[model samples]
Target: MAVVLEVDSVDDPRIDDFRDLKAADRRPDRPGGKGLVIAEGTVVVRRMLDSPFRPHALLGVDKRWQDLAPELAAVEVPFYRASAEVMAEVVGFHLNRGVLAVAHRPPERDFDEVVADATTVAVLEGVNDHENLGSMFRNAAGLGVDAILFGDRCADPLYRRSVRVSMGHALRVPFARVPDWPGGLGLLRRRGFQVVALTPDPMAPTLATALTGDRVALLLGAEGPGLTEEAMTAADVGARIPMSAGTDSLNVATAAAMAFYERVRAS
Candidate 1:
């Protein structure tokens, strides 16, 4: 069982991992960063505890600790209990979520291993927004998408904001980086996945008609630029979600949700 330690002082060195979160050591993508995966709020913290990213410590208000007590019974880490005021002082802001957990990132999953049993997956390119990535993972989890594969210029899915926005689905849903950009997509193709690129172009076939494979990989790009021409060329087909005549495109995450729903609807 985990140990409960009372933290009355904001300067306590024991809770340093929960302090000054804006510092470089907290940002996994920045220089000299510790690459720690931070889960905020009771819900996300619970998900982190259940995920492969094992949390080493947790800091939260008494109420939040009580809410999480059942789940923490099997956990071995220290649970630092503090007042909301002291938590705010230590973390450098008022955190309404009332809880935080920190874990070291596990080794990245292998591309082949992630896709080995996946019947449906989403491949991303240049989708840099952390919120969008989070929403994408949440949508994938809810809609039965098997895994997510990253292409070129994509944001780190384990980033703190991404994990929080995902409601912790970023930790639950399996994902791996696809090497060599569009070229790496060939691995999916060779594995018998029909790569379908989502686009705004009206000339392309609708998703309903374009998706015909037993195994499918949907390719999506950044919001403004959409998929690069090279990525489109690599796909087996280009498909579009029907939209109102005036709108040129949808938000990347929204578009991804629609495509994911299509896959579920078909299955």
Candidate 2:
């Protein structure tokens, strides 16, 4: 069972992992950045506990701790109990979520392992926005998409903001980086997945008509840029979501959700 430790002082060294999160949780390449996967709030923290990330410590208020007590019974980490005010001071912000958990980043899942049993997956390119990535993972989880594969220039989906925005789906959903950019997509193709690129072009077929494979991989790109021409060319087919006359495109995450729904509807 997890140990409950009272933390009255904001300067307690044991809770350092939860301190000054803005700077400490930055990308691993940045100075003072640990690249730890931090889960905020009760829901996300719960997800992290159930995920492979394996949190080493948790910091939250007494009420939040009580709420998570059942789930933490099997966990072996220290649960640092503190007042909301001290938590705010430690995290360097007023966190309304009232709970936090920190885990060291695990090894990235292998691409083959991520896709081996997936009948449907989402592939991303240049989708660097953290919120969009989070929403994409949430949508994927809700709509039965199997896994997520990262292409070129994608943001870390496990970034703190992404995990929070995902409502912890980022922790539940399995994902892996696709090697070699557009060329790597060939692996999916060779594995019998029909790669469909989501585009805004009017000439492309609708997502409903283009997705016909027993195994499918939907490709998405950044909001303004959409998929690179090279990525579009690599796909087995280009598909679009029907839209109103004035709108040229949808937000990447919204578009992804629509496509994911289409896959679910077809199944």
Candidate 3:
């Protein structure tokens, strides 16, 4: 059972963890840097309550607290109630969701473990945009990609923005970072994954034709520069989504969704 304690002061010590979220993010904390996995809004907060990232405390307005009551029952933490104004003063912004919950980051699973039974996985390179990273996870979860692998220069999927963008799917999806650059990709190959580089090159075969393995790893790069020539060369094959002749390539996350959908459309 959880007690809902009202907090009127902007400087309440119990709610200190939610203060100055931006500054706290860079305060030399290990893991996700803020020493916490923050969940904003009613939806994400509920997801956090249901996720492996268990909340220790929550700060929200009266209405939001009422909305969260059912989910909070199983949680052992206190819900620090506050006015929207005071919460704004503490976090340095007017949070529309009027609720927040945070949890310590759990231990990271090794890449090998994440992919042990994966039939379809996404490998990202230089996809630094947090929203894109988040959307990719949402798409992966909805379309049933087994897991996501971060190759190099990717954003923190646990960042507040990423989590919100993922609509809490980021909390459910499994991901792990790979070591080394193109060389790290060899590990997937040795595990019998067919490494297929996703590209915009019209010369490449369509995804429908090029993907021909039971275990497939789609290698993706950031939106603009696409996959590097080095990475393209390292793959077992190159694949392209069928596109309109003059239209631009899809956003990286949207492209990933399309690819993930293709893998599961029949099933």
Candidate 4:
């Protein structure tokens, strides 16, 4: 069982881990980070406890702590109680989430293990926006996609902004970075996953027609550049989402949502 701590001063040394929340992500001495995985709100903090990331300590307002009593019932960590002003002082801003949990990031899963059971997966290349990555995971979780694969040049999924943007879904989704660039795509084909490259090219077949396979893996690229020719040709087929003419292509995450929608619709 965890102890409830009464903290009156913002300078309390016991709550040091919760201090300097902005610089906490930097790894000045540790291997992966000094930046422990910090969950800002009640939802994300709950997710951190449920995910591979385990919280060492919690800092929050009293009401927030009371609200989290059930989730923290068996947790052996200290809940550092503070006022809204102190939390704002420590976190460098007023956190509307009212609660924060800090956890160490777990190891990354291997590529083979990540793809083993996925029937529908989204593969990303150079899709480096943290928000996009977060939205993609949320869409995948809600829309029934099995997994996500980072092809290359993707953003850090565990980044603070990404985690918050994902609404805690990033922690639930399983992902692994692909080893080789375009060549690693062959690995999916070998696993019986029909790899389809999503493109904006009107010449390509519609996504509804292109995504016909027992196991489907959709390849996506960054918004402006789209998929590289090398990445596109590497896949078995190129699929296009039918959109109204003259307007720009959908945002990468939105496009991924549409594809995930198609998968759910098919099932």
Model 4 lDDT tens row, 1-267: 767898888888877766765554542112355646667788888887788777888999999898899989978899999999998887777888899887777778999998998999999999899899999988999998888898878988877777888888888899898889989999999999999998888999998898889899999999999888899899999989999999999999999998888888946
* Per-residue error (Å), model 2, residue 10: 1.5
> What are the runs in model 3 whose C-alpha is more than 4 Å off?
23-32
lDDT of 3 by residue, 1-267 (tens): 779898988878888778887565452122545556788899988887777788888889999988988888887998998888999998888899999887777887799999999999999999999899989988998899999998878898887888889888778888998878878889999999999999988999999988888999999999998887777887999999999998989999999988898788889
Residue 33 displacement (Å), model 2: 2.5
lDDT of 2: 0.90
Sort by lDDT, best first: what order? 1, 2, 3, 4
lDDT (0 to 1) per candidate: 0.90, 0.90, 0.86, 0.85
lDDT for each residue of candidate 2 in 64-136, tens digit (9 for 90 to 100)? 9999999999999999999999999988889999999999887789999999999999999999998999999
- Clashes per candidate (backbone, < 3 Å): 0, 0, 0, 2
lDDT for 195 in candidate 3 is: 97
TM-score of each: 0.96, 0.96, 0.95, 0.93
lDDT of 1 by residue, 241-266 (tens): 99999776888999999989988884
Ranking by TM-score: 1, 2, 3, 4
- Which prediction has more favorable TM-score, 3 or 4? 3
lDDT of model 2 at residue 193? 100
Model 2: which ten-residue window has the lowest total lDDT?
23-32
